[model samples]
Target: MRKVLLILVLCTAMLSAQEKPGESRFLLRGYAHSGVEVRGDETTFVGGSFNPIFLWRQSDKLLFEAELEVEYENGETLIGLEYANMSYIINDYATLRLGKFLLPFGTFAAKLHPAWINRLSSKPLGFGHDGVGPARDLGVELRGGIPLGEAKMTYSVYMINGPALNDGTNPNVEPEEAGMLLYDLGEDNNNNKAIGGRVSFLPLSNSSMEIGFSGLYGKVGNVESKYEDVAALLYAVDFSYVSKVSFLSGVVDIKAQLNGVQVDDASYFNVEDSSNYSFSNKSSAYYVQMSYRPVNMSTDFLNSLEFVGRYSELSFPEGALWTSDQTQYAFGLNYWVDWRTVVKLSYQFADTGAHESEGEEGEASNDAIFLHWAFGF
Candidate 1:
């Protein structure tokens, strides 16, 4: 990965040299956030990660963009690349992106993950590595925007290295993680590639509302492994609406999404207790949120405040040994210092239901309070 980045940098130099003076330039931009959180009885500060984005425009047809993440985890500082891609414009309506990039599986992961734009300090439930979908992946994709009369439409489609399914057949694999799918498997484990895309439509001429549908189908098994034939079909439906309501004298925003994942059934052996198990491998998650800001209020302080609430849930297959159901509720109030800066106070609680086959382990009190400050630069 380092060698590839170096080569891209050299290519950028070559492109810049060929361009007329002042025709090429570079920009640095991204968002950072810091906060305090009280999760159950544990308290900590959330400043462990920093994200930076780099953009270089080498003429109109050629451009390069990359995002790097630096974080402290488990006693060490780690640097990781979220995406490093070069884009070539095919025309006014289409562009091709090559290298690692954020997957457009849903609107939130690809478009609204920035700290200042997320409206809340924490991400919705059913997201992240072991959740519903992938954050990013390596491959190439085609993206475009189209005008359909007064309404607008946008799309993205791509193919990437196959995701790996953890069957927990090996001694190192945990029984609870057996049916999970890992998108960042580092390298391809089979000859097949994963293909997926997202399409969103704005039906109104004002573009105040959007509806989206996304899907991905791929083989998630190693070629020679016992679960080689296992495959997965994943899909999501999402929607967003933002507008000012005259009656309330405020702006209301609503966002929601549902995710479904189905993997081909495969037998899993628990190496710990010498047991075997298998079940219909299916998982699903969903969340709904609504927020209101009194932009039309006479008092500036009242106008700058926003109220938010959300509910989310994650459901795993029932028979899996480590399977569990998770439900979460979050509420927040935010004060905008400016267009790009905000202070947030929020509270959230989570409920986890243990796998039925393993019986109950008692519902643990998983709740949190957050005080965050976010900015975009």
Candidate 2:
């Protein structure tokens, strides 16, 4: 941890020292949110986050960017390096980036994750930093945009240290539990690397609609006698649409997104007891949201207020080791205090399906309410 901090400090100093005369060399910006929530009759204060982002323009084609997030929760403080990367723009068709950064598998992680940008107070199920999808990775990436007539296309391809696998030795650990190997930021467990990319298309020149496809392939596990290598593959499709419509004698904005992922099964063997194991796992998730605002209201507060509704779900195949399928319904109101600040209140209804074992079943559910204030600069 000390080494990481030292590296960041040294990088910052180097960038500052390289600044040319009369030119601004660095930009600092980030977002934060604080809130209070009630769940199952228990209320608590949400301490929120203090994130600092730095950007250094080394030259016309070279740039450096990094972000550090400090969060407090339940009387404990946690700090994380969200991303740090250097990029070189070779041309309009290709840009290369190196170091740790957010995965380019979907639009949400890179585009809509900031507290001030996202419409909801909470993330969708199976899509958080440690959720089923890949949030970030240490790797090298090639990304660029292409102009095609009146439309456009963008692409990102990368190679990185892939997910880590379980050795399948502990009796309490099932083979299918390997699905939990989504985000491993430490050392690479295996010699192989993962390859992934996403491609997006905008068919209409004047429309805010985009369609995308993403995929990943890699092998998980070490090449040891006790452990068998597992081939991991994932594929996803997503789309987003945004538009303005007239409503209630005012203008309302409509925005929505849908996406899902599929993963292949893995096989392994235990050498200690000559046991063979296989994990058949497949999962998917999706969410849709809509918001309405009365732009022409007489009062400033009423004009700044917006109402929102959303529904999301995450599901897995039956009999899987992790068997709790979840669905959530949420409604909220957001008031824009200014261009960079917002106050939000939301209520969520969550239902988790029953897990069946030997004819017995149990399920869980919750209802929660939250009020939060967010700002960015």
Among these predictions, the greatest TM-score belongs to: 1
Model 1 residue pairs with clashes? none
Mark the 10 consecutive residues where model 2 has the least summed lDDT: 354-363
Instruction: Report the Cα RMSD per candidate.
Output: 7.8, 8.6
What lDDT tens digits, residue by residue, belong to model 2 across residues 1-377? 99999999999988987774543379999999999999997999989898889999888888899999899987999999999999999998999999998887676777777888878898877668546567788999999989899999999999998766554554465644544454655567678899999999988896467888888788765566334366567666667766555546554444444444444455445444465645456667777777777776689989888888888887655544565678899899999999879998999988888434334443678889989999998
Ten-residue stretch with the least lDDT total in model 1: 356-365
lDDT over C-alpha atoms for residue 148 of model 2: 90
Over all chains combined, what TM-score does candidate 1 have? Answer: 0.90
Taken over the whole model, the C-alpha lDDT of each candidate is: 0.85, 0.75
- What's the lDDT for candidate 1? 0.85
Candidate 1 regions with alpha-carbon error over 4 angstroms: 1-21, 172-175, 355-362
